[model samples]
Target: MQGPVVTARSARPTVMTDGARRHLFNDRTVARYRHSLSEGVDRVAERISGADRPFTGMSPQRLAPEIAAIDLDQPLGDPSAALDELETVYLRDAVYFHHPRYLAHLNCPVVIPALLGEAVLSAVNSSLDTWDQSAGGTLIERRLIDWTAGRIGFGVDADGVFTSGGSQSNLQALLLAREEALTAAPAGSQLPSDRTELLPKLRIFASAAGHFSVQKSAKLLGLAPDAVITVETGADRRMRPEALERELARCRREGLPVMAVVATAGTTDFGTIDPLPAIADLCEQAGAWFHVDAAYGCGLLVSPTRRHLLEGIERARSVTVDYHKSFFQPVSSSALIVADAASLRHATYHADYLNPARMVEQRIPNQVDKSLQTTRRFDALKLWLTLRIMGADAVGALFDEVVDRAAAAHDLLAADPRFEVVTRSHLSTVVFRYLPAAGQDHERADGANLYAREALAASGEAVVAGTKVDGRHYLKFTLLNPETTLADIAQVLDLLAAHAEHHLAADERRLVRR
Candidate 1:
């Protein structure tokens, strides 16, 4: 109506200047990308090579101010300059998990093949949600899922999706179980059709030693506050089947529906695996969904000699595995595998613009349909590359080495007069504490142990973890690094003992002065 509102094309300069254009990653900037990445890699390599200990003892109080002082609004412009700034803020004091003395958590030193896969995946930037977006990425992830399911002894109906970590995997597994419980109300049971009315009656049974994520997942699923029933564990820290049987009976008598029974394949602190065979039998009798959080003990799946440790895991409805923990992959590589593929439909939702219901009918494989996350990374590439290059047996051997190291460490602590070890783990964790003089009271011992952990961390000599066992403070050595030898464990133990002794002596002097 306004005469077509014609506009003239002006000869204006583009906003993307040559310098800014050079910063972009494209066909033309391949050399720049390679050079920049090489510089960053060199810096990391230098840090790893120079680090004498696992940590620099950089406390938050000291490092926080240094980080907060930086003017992030001011860009360095050059990648090398930014990397140099990173060295001061991050690389210099970063916890080097590759260090043999880093006996803290389930962090494993990554393999080269996985690192290579990381580089490629980051560059490609594939979002593994739909077939159109990911193409081969979808297939690769599916293949990996199939391979993992096969290893898990899941039949042809098995399916799964990669997740951010173990927590998310566990959360999704419980979510699926919750949905199943709601829909498949027992033949004569009184489960309300409305979710709100029935949600309060649902209960999850997990061992006292199981990961806290179970409780967290239950909360997130809108279950009651006391929804998670803690089943007692034996002296070995494994879930007692007898205790579970009694709990199941109690739940039945109380008219509470057993939604899921979570079994820990490898717990966080003690690394003790629950009695899977017995737990599986109990879950079957109770008609509860069986889930195995094999985040730490998933290595046993590949272990040539120790595969029997996970005897009844094949019967689990769902399982969580963290490749980062035992397979030596990089951080944030984990999966949730389910024996029945149909259960994944609980997580699927069709969006018209994205994965429409028609896509499924058309046989278009969209990973988002089965995943909790819509925009997932191509993390499967790392494990794929690792398997292709090193093979599963090689990865399992590395895990075996650490398991052996942990067993040796347990023996070392058991024989030591200055230390007291807890239950021996079938996996790779040893919980112990430095014992002071026999005259010291429990309070003094606890204070000394706490003081020693803090002091040792402050000294930058080594890094270890602390946990409470039976209301008493204890130290934990989660041995995931295969390079950590018995000598390294002995040295760290000596350091801890010295620090504890120093604390006790200082305390005694203070008492005498008082």
Candidate 2:
């Protein structure tokens, strides 16, 4: 009898007996997590929105040592504890991109409308792999694509897919171009040789000012990095059409096949837009695929005033647009649109068990059919809701505000004797530096200015990024926050100039003593 007796056991997870609903997913844990998220969002909006810190750098891997021993399978402490931890360890670590003083790089403020959509989509976990799973989600995403194509004046049948961001969009576009080359060639033929010999002279042309992504794309496409021929740009950073033509001729003389002409609607450093109309014409005459990396400038499509910047974007066979950049959506809102949707037939793959169309009639978009992704997030929800709530006019006007702010910063810097606006505002970015006080050495002062930029960022009170152009290092201010003001930028310049003067004067005294 004593041997047959059982010992007391610990509590187990509650299993509902008279179940009205059996929770298939971890609803309790998930609900707790969501509540915590909302609280953290509120706290962040309240406290840090007005705080002037450049960034809060926290990393999950950094927390591995602390929580590594815990069993994550078991439910985390109810919502309150989770939110507090998220706030302390995760959110506070991110750079408050919306801050007016955050002039680091391409990151920008998150629009409110889009933020709400993000929350809903995340909760729904809508997978856009097929129309059956997506339903209205597919329709909404398709509508967004159509709206963007219409803005760019694409042909009535243009097609597109939402993406994580510009880099992925660019990758997909190049992949499509590679596929086009393969499918267009003779049947039973092998892949075109990436070498200059077999497919020798296979060339991918882009402006020197274009993003490095194009070169990476070429390399990834089996065309070696050397295949990316950097065409010369004029003083304005726009690819000189004449120079592009010269490169094309040189490639042909050497027996290289021109594969594609990649143009930039917005150069990364200078925000310079290549004359797309000219580039499009050149690509047309040469019979090369035309692709435009319009990640930074495609928002101009909605801008009635600045649409002229992209005169021939519609002529491009494919285009990349980052909705996060100009539309104020959160990070990872981007799309790749093709003028001819059928060209994507090259990317289509057949499967029986997963997406077999043997018995069913496919609808307008079975997104998996036309994307680089299969289990895609409902990212289109944010952009779609953003456009729905504010419409195109509001979006365009925000862009105009950024442009005006850049101009304001440029004029202010140019007029000041101690500061120099190196380049006028190109879109929302300005390149400038602290000009040494008169009797100060410009060469020595330039170096000091560069040093000051790094120093400011290291100080952590305020951060303005730095970059080099034409071999000279310069400080760069990318104004993306609408809440930013002239005074804020002026303060940043004053801090940098003062820091430079201090360092430069010390250097002069040291030299004199020597």
Candidate 3:
């Protein structure tokens, strides 16, 4: 009987008073959403803190099939109930990368401050392409470019733009290098219609151990990926200077244009660093573009201890740096920097809406003049906020921490007779695998290690990655977490070694059964 007081329409929406066509989201709704978000975050933090148990493995897929069965029709019921189902169905199975033991990839443990900056950035939705849209955001991003360039030793003339990540940065570097290569060609000979005839038998050079990205960049630039002349490496896994010089001589004699020489500050798979200073001299002597892909290793710039590792980085005409990789910034914080901002003129194009030729006359600093993207993200904010909060020295020290921790992990694993380290630890990766003493050979030991790793992941233990090093298999630990203690690494190794031993013994038992 009390329920009879209910009105036909329970309540009026506040936005309707202003004669606005109704939006599902109103100011009050947004306020509620913010509160809900805060609540959810607090709950997550508490859940993590409440955990008395350690993570066992991260095997990737353990969800019920019904949850993932997709039908595109819009839901017709209470939305909150549907969302709850989805959280358990989909998100529950997702790898918790932030879990301290999930030490698999280059993706770092993102800092809390950077996450806060990102929330504000997503709301503003400023495109960095135009100063009109971005305003203060543009200035902040430019300052970051300047600060990074100065670290690379590119004085006065250095300028760069924030990119999506290393791949995009590499593409832009090669684009500029291609533009520089055709310097003497007819004015019209450029990308969008790069005059093919003007293009020489252009060659790029890099170490054999350089990331596949260097070759990929070459392919994207209209050169065959295989056309990149490979230089043999010495025992340290660095590009041999003599082999590089010999190749340069051969290219010159064959009337091929030597366009660029790429040097890796830290290679992807093995963490190998090509000898930069020696490579720099070769590039200078050959009059080739010296492009350094320091995407993984550029953080060394701020590291007082490791700064010397990248001594010749300044000689690079252009460089790629991924702040996300080692700077503890969120993902997609990468930059492509050139020694002279004028080099960016090559990437400049004219469209009625974008960087019109008239704007160039006014000397307006349109980011579109240098960027590969029309609609780009404001990725610079996270890195800018991070650097500002921690200072250069602190960030550098964190990188030092990664390298040091990785070395300690290597020492710990090496001390155990059960682990066969394929390569001595370098950078932040330790390449090794469990080795059983008697029953199995090297091949079977590798198999056991691989299976052991899978079992570890399947059991929700610790996630460790595997890779081939020098034609042999290995279990690799790529550390980006500065807080990852030696004890943490030791526990994972011990678990892995124990698992491999059990598996090996089982294999031996199976053979005896046969």
User: Residue-wise lDDT of candidate 3 within 1-514, one digit each (tens)?
Assistant: 4555655465654454533332234565686557656765665565456542234333335344554564547552444555566556544445555666777778887887788788778767889987777878888889999999999999999999999999888888888887787664334433223447546467888888787776787777887545688888876777898999999999878767677888888877667678889888989888888999999998898997988888899999999999889788887789999999989888777888867788778877668778888777788888777777878888889889989998888788778888866455457977888887865566787778788788887776678888876776678888888867888888888889888888888988988999
Per-residue accuracy of model 1 over 1-514 as CA lDDT, tens digit each: 5556544433443565656777879999999999999998999888888989988899999999999999988888888889988988999899889999999888999999999999999999999999998999999999999999999999999999999999999999999999999988867676677778889999999999999999999999999999999999989999999999999999999989999999999999899999899999999999999999999999998998899999999999999999999999998899999999999999999999999999888998989999989888999999999999999999999999999999999999999999999999999999999887888865788987898888888888888999999899999999999899999999999999999999889988999999
TM-score of each: 0.98, 0.87, 0.88
Give, for candidate 3, the lowest lDDT window spanning 10 residues.
51-60
Clash number for candidate 3: 4
lDDT of each: 0.93, 0.79, 0.78
Error of 1 at 334 (Å): 0.4
Q: Candidate 3: TM-score?
A: 0.88
Off by over 4 Å in 3: 1-30, 43-67, 70-72, 75-83, 184-200
- The most accurate candidate by lDDT is 1
The alpha-carbon deviation from the true structure for residue 241 of candidate 2, after best TM-score superposition, in angstroms, is: 0.2
RMSD of 2: 5.3
Tens digits of per-residue lDDT, candidate 2, 235-288, equal 777899999999888876775667788999888787778999999999988778
Ordering by lDDT = 1, 2, 3
Better of 1 and 3 by TM-score: 1
